[model samples]
Target: MAEMKTLTAAARSGTGKGAARSVRREGRIPGVIYGGGDAPEPIALDYRELNKLIYAGHFLTTIFELEVDGAKQRVIPRDYQLDPVKDQPLHVDFLRLKAGATLRVDVPVHFINQETCPGIKKGGLLNIVRHSVEMRVPADAIPDAIVADLGKLEINESLHISAVPLPDGCKPTQRDRDFTIASIAPPIAAPEEPGAAAAAAAAGKGGKGAPAAKAAPAAKAAPKPKK
Candidate 1:
């Protein structure tokens, strides 16, 4: 489960583009906390502190205890915007977490046991279909990732969502079909395809080994001198 962290913010009375720009000029990031039944609250966080947390990864999935005006509330980042050219954070939106509430999040997929997998041992490539799975889970007990085991997979065999165990209280939003997560793909050139790899390599060399076109029959030596 992802551990909740703490962040500090100052209450903001101002709103709109002009106000946000002013906040940025003062080395603070403009943001808002909404949802959970109460009205939206405007807030500002220290620029450097927020930037570090944003770049640390899993900013959206990780829950946070937001402290504003010395009062704390549980929340999770819903979205954020960045500058087009500079890539600096422009705005952020957070959602309040109510008791026993469930939140939808994209959890990362972690694969395991490649060393003992028969397909991998036989030179099969692990082709990942989904890097993450979107699921609804308890806000207080969000999972870190979904684990996919590759030990039982063979070449051309797939690992579906049903094959792996999901975290408790977490259910995938894709309930209609058992989606494929990963698979052991066969090698590009099978052993039966003799010289396929060699041919591909030669083709990469700009036709270096290819036979030249036979010179066109010499045009019959410019029509018979005997004529």
Candidate 2:
């Protein structure tokens, strides 16, 4: 399960563009918390602190104990937006968690025993089909990642979602059929260097069509100066 994190936010009084812009001018990010049978609450987080956490990775999947004013709420980041030009956080949407609720999220895939993987040692490439998988998980028990074993996989063999074990009560979203997670692909032949084939053909023609070295017409015997 992913580790729990804590963050502090201040409740904002208003909503909409003007309010959000005003919050940003105060050097904080505007956000909202909704769901779990409650009215949405507008909130704000210190810009520097929010940027640090976002860069830490997996912010959406990581659960948080959010403290707004003096009260705490359990929540997860459902979504967030970034400025297209500046690439900075514009807003965040948090999903308030309630007891006995299940959530669908993309959990990262972790490959293990790669150094000893049969296919990799044999010059085969490990082609990843899915870096993360969406699964239905208990909100209180979300996993940080799922493991994919590669110790015994060989070239031309594929690893499917079924091969990896899931935590109890956790299920992949796709239940219809087994899906591929990764595969070991056969090595590809290196392409010949540019013009090498044509150069070889030219050299072969020269070998048969023209002598590499020609003897000068036998020099006429020195006309007998002696004769």
Q: Distance (Å) between predicted and true CA of 93, model 2?
A: 0.7
Q: Which stretches of candidate 2 lie over 4 Å from their true place?
A: 193-227
For all predicted structures, in order, the TM-scores are 0.83, 0.85
lDDT per residue for candidate 1 within 25-67, as digits (tens), equals 9999999999999999999999998989999999999999999
Candidate 1: residue 11 Cα off by (Å): 0.9
Q: Which pairs of residues have clashing backbones in candidate 2?
A: none
Taken over the whole model, the C-alpha lDDT of each candidate is 0.94, 0.93
Q: How do the residues 1-227 of candidate 2 rate in per-residue lDDT, one tens digit apiece?
A: 98889999999998999999999999999999999999999999999888888878989998999999999999999998888999889899999999999999999999998899999999999999999999999999999899999999999999999999999879999999999999999999899986898777777885553447866887677666773
